[model samples]
Target: MYKYDNFDQTIVNERVEQFRGQTQRFLSGELSEEEYRPLRLMNGLYIQRHAPMLRVAIPYGLLSSKQMRMLAQIAREYDKNYAHFSTRQNLQYNWPDLERVPDILADLASVEMHAVQTSGNCIRNTTSDQFAGIAPDEIEDPRPYCEIIRQWSTFHPEFSYLPRKFKIAVSGATHDRAAVRVHDIGLYLVKNGQGETGFEVIVGGGLGRTPYIGPTIRSFLEKKDLLSYLEAILRVYNRYGRRDNIYKARIKILVNELGKEEFTKQVEEEWQHIKNSVLILDQKEIDRVKAYFTEPDYDQNAGDDTGFESALNENSAFTSWASRNLADHKVAGYKAVVVSLKAPGIAPGDATDAQMDFIADIADEYSHGEIVVTHDQNLVLPHVKQADLFTLWNKLSEQGLATPNIGLLTDMICCPGLDFCSLANAGSIPIAKQINEKFDDLDYLHDIGDIKIKMSGCMNACGHHHVGHIGILGVNKKGEEYYQLTLGGSAENDAALGDRLGPAFAKAEVANVIESLIQVYINNRDEDERFLDTYRRIGMEPFKEKVYENN
Candidate 1:
């Protein structure tokens, strides 16, 4: 983790004082609702349906144990005794007092954290693969560059108020765990044929009312030009992107209207001049940033843990959780542990205050003193000793954090729908709960393997419904909530939009509809194929009919 220098600390302290003044003005009626709207948004405060919501940024999905404890304290004192982790790897407090938000910001600033750029028209959080450094498939760690972008974009006056909100994601791994393809700007850290490192820049990818998997704007961009190239892209979008209609404001809409060829040409023309400018990152600075992320001291020669294998064989529960929750770590004798947040009956990604402290303790005790928030609404201990798997599992299970349902049908990504969001037409958390209860069998869920079911309250695609293997969108019909289903969507490499599966279903009928689709998949799947693989191979005709025939 990059500790904030004196300059960074000063920046946050200044913002807290600034936000305090703005908040005072708004409350005292000196700032009208129209005037206060953007100000509050910039501070990551939203007046939701029931109460004010505060979104705190967890930069590139990395947070220290100390920071986690701070969040737990915030949740305990400021809002309800829990916080919602967003799909973008940020945390949301649903019921914070608007008057006290500045205090929250000040508290966050104390721990080198804040809500800056977590919302607003400027650049949002710069996310990356949660398994960035530790993933065996990674070419290099993406965090150094993510941190660079985080620093560059933090207070850039030029991009603070874009046509609409902008998002960026970087993936260093061979597989796209970060869902880079659907961000406004997606950077794939890659090595060229000559072994030179750079980015494969993909632009105009987003999911909202109009969904798009961004086209490759640049085949290869050198590492030195990362910030400059990004500036060029933002400048192009900021110059020409539509500001007339909120619905048509995202860069994806602009890219689609202009076409990729023309967009690429414009970006190239802009990049030509700026590529060699001062914005170009110096190798020494890049190395300095990279130095902060070096691996924890490990037992280098601790090759194979026989005890870990023995634990797996002896305990069925431990083995089950390990199979689903544990992923291969880059280092030997270590594993990346996925703490599933999609526990049954609870809102997905809502970690209670006690749970946060517990998870923080687990990270300190079992893994390194750090945690990574996964895009799939899970917490990850990126470096856990293999021998400690059982102990970690037992501790997590006791706290209702160890579901062992990673990538299963029940492990769904859902937005804080009508329950919290004013924009949501229908409730998403309830739909997730309904679907989760319907598909509660672990064995059955595992059999219907590698399924991603995402639910969104509206077309904003906050839940990333457009990229799930099974996408569910909530719609309001005659003031009643209905759920619409989309099939074959994926956020992985070769990202594609999901196909809609006919008419929407009532809230009560949602669980049955999902079951019908699951049954269809099981009946039609080929040998060893995942839900997505089967969907691509077999197409949507079978699943579509199964879902709609009885409706």
Candidate 2:
């Protein structure tokens, strides 16, 4: 709920006009594709297999009702009436005319939104927990810091073109819902022994061809030095990170080659020079930014309603949906509801314009006119009264938006594979569909409980496959799609990369492989143990044996 000021509005307006001129020149053949690639990519436009894909940044996945309505309008007028939500909490339109991108940018600017830094080798979106303010376990709200980073990194001349794209995630919660450990820079907001809040900085974490969980370079970083320290890390990477090969260009790769101690030393040296610079945040400036994210007023008298309890007793369907979709909130008598985008038959995270509009309406009517896009390819109404649960469920169910499969197998994180992405080696959407339908039983899914199935069409890991409880990476083996499995991975506080299963399964065998793995879990799991807990306890051998028995 951060609002744009005159300075913010002016900057966006100027950037839109600048990009508009660049686009016109590219279309008029004044610049060749080679010359225009960087320009277009910096503006978040990608030439996909079928059409130009435009990614719009949703900063820290927060959006107002008015902004959500504008997105719905953009999808209807510019895209093919549907948009895809990405793992970075960004939205993508698969079919947008290149000529009208400026118009879309102009429309987005009006809403304090833009596509800036969504693509190319600069800093990408700064992600945080979707449950930032409402989560009971949170240390502090991370959105204000995320906003600070957004402003600092937006077209920062020093980091405009790094060796490769950079990612940063902030987690104010005890549990890491933001996948902080898998980002290039994971900032865990922490309180020291003195009860002074600062950051526990984890550097060089990323997933791709060479997956790495960045080591903690600093156990404690002062809150005032966040941006300065971040700049130091980037400066170190930019100065020494490989530019010789695109494969070795990421900061993770550099950290791996140089060893964590050396990397930490370099960053420390750089930080000493910049720690007291203009980037050093003051209490006044921090408070000013935090003011934009103040909590909404609520009725103190609003407690658990008897009507809601009655509805739960009477309607099994509502009960099931509520159990899966609703999350605990810090505020009593309030719930954070996740709106599933992974309904059966549709591509994961693809929401039609109508669906987006409906969500906006619901957000206004129930969630204080605010919405949140989760990093897990879902939308969230972060503040819903417990009394209005049944009514909200009815509205959501009517629109096919209430799937009740949050944290289940069907609620998987997936990328636009061969369906749209040119770099993809196989189709991920179809595989997700197969798994979704295979695990169609709600009772069975609820019984199994909290299985994260993340699939990527390639090693780019756009789907965040490496961090899923069950990670599936698509590969091409002699023109055939082969799915590789990895198990025991998680993006939580105790984050660890998954180990690869013995061999890759053919596209047809992927679902069967998943089923066999699940059966292994069912056989070995202790009572009430989740998929991840079972995997951790028994390791991957049992599942690997079950999966490759026929191979």
Candidate 3:
């Protein structure tokens, strides 16, 4: 984890005071709502249907145990007793009082976290793989680059106000766990034929009203030119991207209208001027950032533990949990354990104050005093010892944080729909509850295999429904909530938007519809194939027919 320097601390302190004044003025009627709107947004405060929601950025999803404890404190004192971890790997407080938000910001600044750039039409928080440095298949750690971008983009006067909000993601692993293809700017660390590492830069990929898998604007971008090239791309978009319509203002829309070839050409022309400028990253600076993410101390003698093996053999419940929740690590005798927040009746990404405090304690005792927030709304103890697996599992189970459904159907990505978000047409939490109740059987979920069910309350695509193996979208039909279904979408190496199944189902019928789709998969799937693989092989007709046959 990167610690804040004096300059960083000073800036944050100043901003908190600044926002405090702004918030007071707004309340005292010195500043009107219209005038305070952008100011509040710049500080990551949103006026939702019920209250002001405060979104705090967890840079690149990295957190120290100390920071985690602070988050727990904030949830306990400032907002409700729980916080929601979002799809963007950020945390949200849904019930914070408007007058006390500046106090919350001050508390966050003490822990070196902030809410800046979280809501505005400026560059948002840069996200990356939760398994960045520890993943066995990684070419290099992407966190350094992500941090570099965060430093460069935060409060950059040139990009302070774009036509629409922009998102950037980086991935260093062989598989794209960060969903880079769905971002405004996606960078993949790659090796050339000569063994030189660089970036494969992709632009214009986004999902909202329009969905696109961003095209590779540059086949290979040199390491030294990363910032310069990114600046060039942003410059191009800033100059030509639409400003007339909110829906058409995103860079994805611009890329679609201008065509990829023209967009690439313009970015290249813009790059030539800045490529050799001071923006070019040198080895010293790169090494400085890289130093912050160096591996934690490991016991070199750590090897296969007999106790761990024995425990797996003795307990079927632990075995099932391990199979789904644990990921392979680069180092032997260690694993990255995902602490699932999606329990049977809980909302997808929520953690209570007590749970956060306990997780902080566990991270200190087990995972090198660090924690990671996954894009799938789970917490991760990235460097857990294999020898302590059973003990850790038991502790997590006691906290109700040990759900063994990592990639299964119940472990779905869902947004705060009508319950919290005014933009939502339907209630996502209730629907999630219905689905959880309908598919409570762990054995049945295991039998069905990995199915990503992403739900969005509306078309903003906060749930990333477009890339789910099974996508559920909520729609308003004459004051009643109706759910639309899409199948075969994926956010992996082979990224694709899901195809829509015919008509929308009524709210009560959603669970039954999902069951019908699962049954169709069970009937036609080949041995060893996952839900996504079977859906791709069998296509949409079977699932669509099964759902709409009785309609």
TM-score to native of every candidate shown:
0.99, 0.99, 0.99
Candidate models: Cα lDDT each? 0.92, 0.92, 0.93
Candidate 1 residue spans exceeding 4 A from truth: none
The sequence of per-residue lDDT tens digits that candidate 1 reaches over residues 2-26 is 8899988999999999999998998
Best lDDT among the predictions, by candidate number: 3
User: Which portions of model 3 miss their true places by more than 4 Å?
Assistant: none
Model 3 RMSD to the real structure? Answer: 0.8
- Scanning candidate 3 in windows of ten residues, the lowest lDDT window is 299-308
lDDT of 1: 0.92
Backbone collision count in every prediction? Answer: 0, 0, 0
How many clashing residue pairs, candidate 2?
0
Q: What lDDT does model 2 reach?
A: 0.92
lDDT, candidate 3, at 79:
77
The sequence of per-residue lDDT tens digits that candidate 2 reaches over residues 60-160 is 99999999999999999987898989899999999999999999999999999999989998999999999999999999999999999999999899898
